[model samples]
Structure formats: C-alpha cells, structure tokens
Target: MKSTPSNQPEQSVQKTFTNLINALEQNNYTNFISQGNPAFKEGLTKQIFTHVSEQLAPRLKKGYSSVFLTKLNQQGYQVYLWKLSFKDGSDDIVARLSLKDAKVAGFWLN
Candidate 1:
C-alpha cells in the first residue's frame, strides 16, 4: 500500500520494519541495515547481527507471526510495538523510528 501525506510517517516506518524482518530472515544484513538511521547503521555490524540472530534462533525455529500492537509518539520519535508469536510462546518487538526523518533509530526483540 502507498502511504499518503497524512499518515506517511507511520506507513513508512511499518514498511521499513516489514522489510527489515524479511531481509534478516533471508540473511541479507546489507539490505536490513540499509533501512536504518545513521546511528543504527554505524553501530550495527555483521558480528552483532549474527549474535542477535543466534540469540533469537530458538523462538524463530518454526518461523514466527507478528501483529502490530500499538504506536507511541514521543520526542519526535514514533515507537511501534509488535507482538511476535512463536510456536512455543510469544514476545514483544519494539521499533523506535524517527518519523521526522523516516528512519529506524532503534529496534529490539524480546
């Protein structure tokens, strides 16, 4: 879906998150980090990505499902909450996006 001006930021952030997950699943770290903000890009490395992926491997074994839970806007940042469901359990994923610039400033899978 295309985003209109009114809801462009939210839509863009959502799309970014979707694409990031797809890239990660495909082991395409370059494409994944390309969607990040400057700081995110600077801080994330291949080793870090590998470590994080390994840590989440158990929950991702059967693959997973996701649902958009909510969004909170504060201090120019839009924090999107997503619920990730695995075969064994569930967890929360947080994406702190900078809507003002349409970039992902931070992300967490817990």
Candidate 2:
C-alpha cells in the first residue's frame, strides 16, 4: 500500500524493528519497551518480556534479518509486516509490528 502520513512512517519504524530484535537477543526489557507507546509499555510487563526473550533467544543468537513487506493502517495504528529470515536457514517467519504515535504498540511473529 501507498505510504500515508497519518500512520507512522515506515522508514523510522524499520530501524525500531531491528532494535526490537537486538533487545530480544540481549534480554534488555528496559530497552525493549523503551520506545513502546504508553499503553504498550504498561501492558508488556517485564515478566512477559523475559518469557519472550527466553523463547526467542536461541533464534536471535543464531542471527536473523528482516525484509519490509508492507504497512497497513488499522485501528489507529500502523501495522507493518516483514519477512524474517534466520541465518541458520530455518523456515522464514512473518513478523508483524503495530505502531501508535511512532511507538511500538504490538509485535509478534507467525
């Protein structure tokens, strides 16, 4: 889809996505939610972050990269998609990140 100013711009958010991965690898809960929106920061507790970090740590350590796919404007957020490829040649995963007011609102992989 074409870019829109209302939704957070993709250029900056792309870099944030990389930072998210870095946070996961390092298990830095503070850094992980540092850029999150107020609601996101409140909702994503350190316990939750720790759990996710532990789960994804292996793949993260193996190294990975993402390719921007598209961005969708929905429910007052900018939903960005990417193709996440692991360096270990594991199957690729679809990564989704939602941003509100230029901050991360939600994120997941499928």
Candidate 3:
C-alpha cells in the first residue's frame, strides 16, 4: 500500500516500526540505520550497532508482543509509543518513536 501524508500518523509510525524490527531481526544494521534521520545515522556507528544488536539479541529471539500506548505531537514531530512484551522476563519494552518528513527522526526502545 502506498503511504501518503493523509494516512493516519499511527499507521505510518507502526509501519516504520515494523520495518525497523524486521531489519534488526535480519541483522541488517545498514538497512536499519539508513531509515533513520541524519543525526541518528551520525550517532550510530558500526561499533554501537554491534553493541546494541548484542544487547537486544536475546529478547529479540522470542520476538515481541505489542500494544499501542499513546501518541503525541512535539515540535512538529509525531511521536508514537508502544508497550512491547518479551519472553525473557525483562521489563516491558516501551518503544518511543518520532517521525518527521515521513522518516524516523528518533527512536528509543526502553
């Protein structure tokens, strides 16, 4: 499906989040980073990517169960939050993502 500005912000953010998850699952950090904002790309290097991948590998193994939490608009950016459940008994993952210009401007998986 083609995505346009008229699409719901939640739908757009969800699609982007799904794609990011797929890239992470496949160990395609390059593809994953390419989707981020310029500053995100600059902040994440190969070493950092490797570290993050290692840290997330275990929880990601069991995949995730997600519940939409909320949405907010801050400084012209659209932010979406999701509560993620993992099998490893870790704290629930709170995924906070900010979207700008149809791309991911920021992302946090806590």
Candidate 4:
C-alpha cells in the first residue's frame, strides 16, 4: 500500500503484527504473539520486559508515559518501531520490528 501522512505508521504497524499473527495462526502456532518474537526476522525479535526495563532504567523521565509506533524507510524496506512507557517515573520499553515474507520479524529492545 502507498504510504499516507495520516495513518502510515499505524498501517505499517498493523500490517506487521497481522502478518506475524497470520503466519503463526496458519501454522497452528496459536501462542505466537504471547511467545514473543520467537521467529527471528531480519535478526530481530520481541524483547522481554525484563530486558526492556534494564535498558530504560537510566533514561526514564517523569510523566513521560506513552507508547508509539513509527514506520521508517531503510535500505528499500519498511521498518517499524514501537515504544511502551508509563507515567510518573515508570519504565519505558522500545522495540524495533521489521516485515519479511508477510511476517513480523527483527525485534530489538531500546
């Protein structure tokens, strides 16, 4: 799909998630999302909360809770970045995901 200003990021994120979920569902991998990026795509996978916590422990700011998803163009492919955070000095988690073969892959905690 051609990218648009209003919903490009959301569309890409949804597509990436759907692609991963569909592939797992078709293969009878019901616990795919819950399993957390077990299938590596582009050398990235979903990171555990523990891993995320450690990364954000030092950079967290107060009242800065928010989750975000962004679509980026890289080397001729689309990449997605997701960030989850909480308010009032809470930990923040960030992940980078990529799409490949109609599947979500390549996750990293930031």
Q: Candidate 4: lDDT of 27?
A: 38
**In candidate 1, what are the lDDT values of residues 1-110, reduced to their tens digit?**
99434423356667887777776666677887887878888988888887776666566666787777667788887777776777776654543434436777877766
How close is each model in CA RMSD to the real structure?
Answer: 5.3, 3.6, 5.6, 8.2
Give per-residue CA lDDT, model 2, range 1-110, as digits (tens): 89555433356887899888889889999998998988889998999989988988798798887778888889898898888889988888898999888888998878
**Weakest 10 consecutive residues, lDDT, candidate 2?**
3-12
**Best candidate, lDDT-wise?**
2
- Candidate 2 Cα misplacement greater than 4 A, ranges: 1-9
Q: Mind giving the per-residue lDDT tens digits that candidate 3 earns over 46-100?
A: 7877777777766778767877777788999988888878877788878888888
In Å, residue 48's CA in model 4 sits off its true spot by: 8.3
List the candidate 4 regions with Cα displacement exceeding 4 Å. 1-12, 15-30, 33-66
| Clash-forming residue pairs, model 2 | none
Off by over 4 Å in 1: 1-9, 90-100
Question: In order, how many clashes per candidate?
Answer: 0, 0, 0, 3
TM-score of each: 0.73, 0.84, 0.81, 0.44
Cα lDDT tens digits for candidate 4, 1-110: 89656333565466655444333324323333432344552233334433444444444433333344677778755677666564654556665766554455564555
What's model 2's TM-score? 0.84
Q: What is the lDDT of residue 16 in candidate 2?
A: 92
